[model samples]
Structure formats: C-alpha cells, structure tokens
Target chain A: MNFIRMKYTKWFNISKDGLSKNNPIMIAVLGICSALAITNQVENALAMGAGVTFVIVGSSAVISIIRNFIPARLRMVTYMVVISSFVILVQMFLEAYFPFIFAALGPYLGLIITNCIVMGRAEAFASKNPIRYTLVDGLANGLGYTYVLVLISIVREALAFGTILNIRVMPEAWTDWVVMAIAPGGFFVLGAIIWIFRELTNNYENA
Target chain B: MKDYLKMVIFVLILGVTTATVLTGMDALTRERIEENQLIVLQDAILEASGITDYDDTISTFEANLEVIEAEGKTFYIDGEGRVSYTFEGLGVWGPIFGVITLEADFETIAWITVIDQEETPGLGGVVEERTYLDNYVGTSMYPELRVSRTADADDINEVDAIAGGTRTSERFEAMLNEAYQAHRDVWLTLQESAGDA
Candidate 1:
C-alpha cells in the first residue's frame, strides 16, 4: 500500500469523513452524555475515550460481518445485543487489569450501551460496508470523539482543579472553579468547543 | 412464516454466542479480578499501618500484619500495637469499604484508607481522598466521631465534613461509628487478656 497519493484512496476518504466532516461530536452531535460526564478529569476522559473506541470497533466489526444475515425486524435488537456484549467485555477487562479506572468510571462504564454513536455507525456504515471499510470508519470516528473529549478535559481539569492529568500546572494561589468539576460546567465547555470547531471547519447548518 | 423462523434462529444464535463468549471471558478473568480486589484491600491495610515499598504485597502483608479472630470479628495487628480492621457500610449511592487503623490507645486514629467507595466525584467522593481521610488522624473515636460542617476546631473527636456532601457526611459518620462499635468489643477482650498475661 504505497500511499504518497493517500488523499485519493477510498479508506482515506472514509476516515476523513469520520474525523472531520461528520465528527461524532462537532458535526453529528452524538455521545454527549458521556462527553459531559467524564470530561471533568483528563484521566477519566482518556479511559472513557479508550473504552468507547474499543466498543465501537468491536461492535462495528461484529455487525458488519453479520450484516447480510441480519433480519430486517431484528436490526435494532441485533445492534443492541452486539454493542452490550462488547461493553461487558470492556467492563470485565478493566475490572481485571485496571481496577482503579474501573472504580473511577463507575456507572458511566455500564452506560456505554446507550451511546448513540456506536449504534449510529452500525446502522449507517457497517451494515452497508465491508469489514475493511468498517474498521477504518470505526477507528476514525472513535479517534474523532476521543480527541474532542481530551481537548475539553484539558480545559476543564486545568480550570477545575488547577492541574493537568493531576500535575499541578497552575500557581499555588490559583482558586479552583467548582463549576468546571460539575455537569453544568461540562455543558458550557462542550458547547463552546463545538462552536469553535464548527467555525474553524465552516460547518454551518441553515434553517 | 420463514421470516419469523429466521428471526428466532438469529436471536437464538446471537444469544448463545454472546453468552458463550462472556462466560468464557468471565471464567478467564474472574480469578484475576478477585485477586485485584483482595490486593487493594491488603494494600490499604498495609499502608494504614505505615507499611510500604515492599517487594510483594501479599507476602509482605502476611509477614508483617498479624490477623486475630475473636468473637467472629477479625482484626489486623501491626508490630507497633496499632490495630486495623475492615469497615463496610452504605454511602449515599452505594457501599463504602475501608480499613481504619487505630493507635495503641484504641481511641486515636493511626491512619484511615478508603479502599473502595461509590460516592459522587468531587463531592461525596472526597471520602476516599487522602486529604479528607487525613483529618481522621489523631482524632479520637472514643464515644463517637462527629463529621460536621461546624466542626469544633479544638475538639479532636470532630472533623470537618465534605462541604457539598452533607448526606454523604452524615452517612459516613454513622458508618464509622457503627464499625468502631462493632470491633470495639473484641478489641476490649484482647486488651484485657494481654494485661492479665
């Protein structure tokens, strides 16, 4: 796969579409609940980002492989089952290997089952695409969500706790902002970031 | 109809496959997960008793901490006569588990470590924090330990509670007092036996 001319490739296009044009957060407006809940801390954001990425890749691959045999009436049900299975695998692995993160994530770990982005990809892309394309799409979308979350968390954690990844970056006299550690603070930061992202990308939706 | 049959078969296969995979994963990881939990509890106990930087947690814990069971109660005795015991009780959302180490007097706290808790982060979750638990140090659990917003600064028995987590503070107060009372009886008996001997 010589890729000096990578911009012309189908995989590149799918990835570009996912990472920028149809981002899970800035463009698609998907998976906001988790984005808000976990972005207060950089560590939680990273853990959640990794977890969601894994779930998305796992479920998308499974759904794409079985897309042909899936009954029309069972489409939603199939997605639910596949997604939940992957979520449970994530829970078990984290509890076993990273118990600290497992405890930190709390209810949000189980709530991955309800994330719309995973199901959205399954229905829109995986069901219609081959596994090769599905994998790229999943990776691109997962990274897209993750980078945005990390960005938001950097801002929130710095302001909320005067630290970045638990390292004290702010001066000793810095007063912590309680709002940034709570849900409403997440809303404000996420909204601002989304607006700035849209401005930079020129993604405007007119009524 | 054939479509209905297809649906049923697809569901059955998916269910069985998911079940099999999860069961296999659980079988593989269950031991490690259980071990990880035990390691946390053990480490907390060791750290509470001022033990750290050991080669292996389990071995060092066994070598250092002596466990005694009396009246169906278990207590870990450190070399320095400090006593540590596991405590479990309800927090606001779920259970809180920790090890509380008391000084030789059995009244003043040596150290306290929250091994596991399910309180809300940045609020009730501060119960597990080192800074918050540090407040327990030198505080007497004699009579009862009070967690209050207006903690009497001079009173060692009263410590400042989490500012935004009143319910959690109240629950924590009750939980600690209950655990103290539960373990105090066995501790008293051991003290008397040692005095006589």
Candidate 2:
C-alpha cells in the first residue's frame, strides 16, 4: 500500500513520465538524429549518453532557477545561450581529456545544442517546474534516451563487428553484417525497438 | 517601460554570465588541448618512420626524430633519411589532418597516418583505417598520387580508393597531391642544404 501510494508523489510521476510515458526517443521521437548517428558502438553510446545527461540536467536546473524572470520576448534565445554554453564546455572537456572519443564524435558533439530533447525539456518541464523537480526530470529523460541508444548499439555492434564493446563474442568464422554498421542499420534497429517498446507499454496512437 | 528595462538587464546579465563561464573554462583547457594535438601529430610522425614501440610517444618522438624547420614547414627526419611531415586537406565533410612519411628519394611513400578527420562513420571514415592507409606504402607521390577504384595499386603513383566512400576518396586524393606539391619545394631545399653541409 505504501509503495503504491508512493507512485502518486510529484517526483515519482515526473520521473515516470520522463523515463517511460514520454520517453524522448521511443514515445516522443525527439533527438532521433543523434540516436541513429552514434549508436554503432556501445562505447560511443555511453560517452554520448553521459555528455547529454550532463547537459540536460545542468541546463534544466539553470532554467528552472530563473524561470520566473525569463523575459517572454527572449525566452527562446535565453534557452539557446544556456544550452549552447553547456555544449561548448562538453566539447572542450572531451577534446582536452579524451581526444580519441572527441575525434570519433566529430561534429555530432557540437550538435547536442540543437538536439530537440534538450530544447524540449527547457521549454516544457524546466520552464514551468521548480529546480528540484526539473533536476529529476532531466536525469530520467537523459537516462531514458541513453538506455535505448545503448540497447540499439549493442545489437548493431555485435552483428556489425562480431564483437561487444570490441570484445569478440561471435564465432571467428562469422562475417560481419556490414549493413548493421551504418545509418540504415540504425534505422532498422531503432524502428524495431520503437515497435517492441510501444507494444509492451500498450501505447497506441489513434489515427 | 519597466518591461523593456528588465528585458535588457536580463539579456545583458545572461550574456555576461555565459561568456565569463566559457572563457574561464577555455582558459583551463586550452593548454591541455593544444598539448594533446601536438602529441597526436608527433605520434603519427613517429609511426610513419617505423618507430612503433615506445613507452611514451611524445618523449620517444623527441628523442629519436630530429626536427628540421625550414621553408615555413616542420619536418621530422629519422636516422634512415626517412622524412615525415604533417599534411592538411579537406575531405567530404571536414578537414583531414595526417602525416606523410617519404623514403630517402622523397618520392616513395614510407607510411601514412591520418591524425584526425571528420568523415561519415563506417563509410568515409575508412580513411583512418590501417588497412586503407596501408595501401599507400611503397606508392610514389611525385607528379601527384592517384586514388583509383579501378587503377592498379601496384602502379607507382596509384593507390586504391575507399569503397562506398567515393567522394571522400576523391577528396583525399586531391588533398594528398596538394600537400605534396606545397611541400615539394621545401623538401628539395632541405636536401640541397644537407648536401652542402
């Protein structure tokens, strides 16, 4: 009974919505561009996830702190500044500390500022909610996007490279599924994942 | 009137705050990023000269290779007269940075290594792969180098292009040729000076 009642709390609902009811990728279909671009390797997925997670949470908290004072005329511009500031910081940090991943991510690292999910959270939840709630919301949504990317990349990498995290798991004789290493492979895996996820969650759109 | 004043103030404060934060962070990381870039170029130069085994790439590069600066470009020369220099070229997506090492003749490719590139992954990204770069070894670069999907790799000036990354391959071919041309005069100058000494 206590656990059931816990679900009614504001934090719980916010987290649940971000993680499941309104998942950035599967349900809302936001940020699919990056999801497909970087999901060929699990390591890239993890690094990108961490980067995105930090930005979302950081930006959301900042927006929530100044939500009441944002000028109506310049609200969107303000969000862009904050979001891009975080993105540039991530780019520089990665370039300095993790040059290999920095080179691998290439232009996509800078594209995080334009990711719809980051802008969406800033517009929707963070702009109206308190900092405390926005923090949890940001974390949940970031992880939600991350886990899906990782799951997709696992399948893609294994089939494409005959390895998981570069560790060989398949028989040596197995020829790589070359298609699975490219954008079309991301499309196929992502489409199927969205389908399975929706069916399991009983989410159906009325046409 | 109050709304206008408040809006201006808010925008100014936000701009200043973001700029300050970014500037501060840049100050912290700028040196490290530059250092890492130098290390990468050095490592590629070392690899091109066939010095692959080492404890520290930077220290090994400093100790083993002699740096010769002339004609506005830097060159790394090993004991065997192999010469390595950095090359810059544009690819399909963005700039490609690499190191090209030449045998004593300054015509035959000793080795090639891409230090950085921004090509599409799994396609044009193959430019960075060892298998692809290996094709350049023993190929001649004088009078221009050709990356052909059809031309024979064994031909003196011909090397294989990246399959499915035709545009990138074409761009890479142009880039290598351009770099060789830019460096050719300096390479000859250095050779004359060495002979005079």
Best by DockQ: 2
lDDT of 2 by residue, B67-182 (tens): 98986898888989898888888888999999999998889999899977889989999999999899899999988898878956767899888889999999999988888888
Interface RMSD of every candidate?
Answer: 0.5, 0.5
Cα lDDT of all candidates, in order?
0.92, 0.92
The sequence of per-residue lDDT tens digits that candidate 2 reaches over residues A121-155 is 99999999999999999999999999999999999
| Ten residues in sequence with the least summed lDDT for candidate 1 chain A | A1-10
For each candidate, how many residue pairs have backbone atoms clashing (under 3 Å)? 0, 0
Badly placed stretches (over 4 Å) of model 1 are A1-8, A157-185, B52-56, B70-72, B105-109, B119-197
- Tell me how far the alpha carbon of residue A57 in candidate 2 is from the true structure, in angstroms, after superposition: 0.4
Models 1 onward score TM values of 0.81, 0.86
Q: Which stretches of candidate 2 lie over 4 Å from their true place?
A: B89-94, B117-136, B139-197
| Distance from true location, Cα of A153 in model 2, Å | 1.7
Q: Which 10 consecutive positions of candidate 2 chain B have the poorest summed lDDT?
A: B146-155
Docking class of 2: high
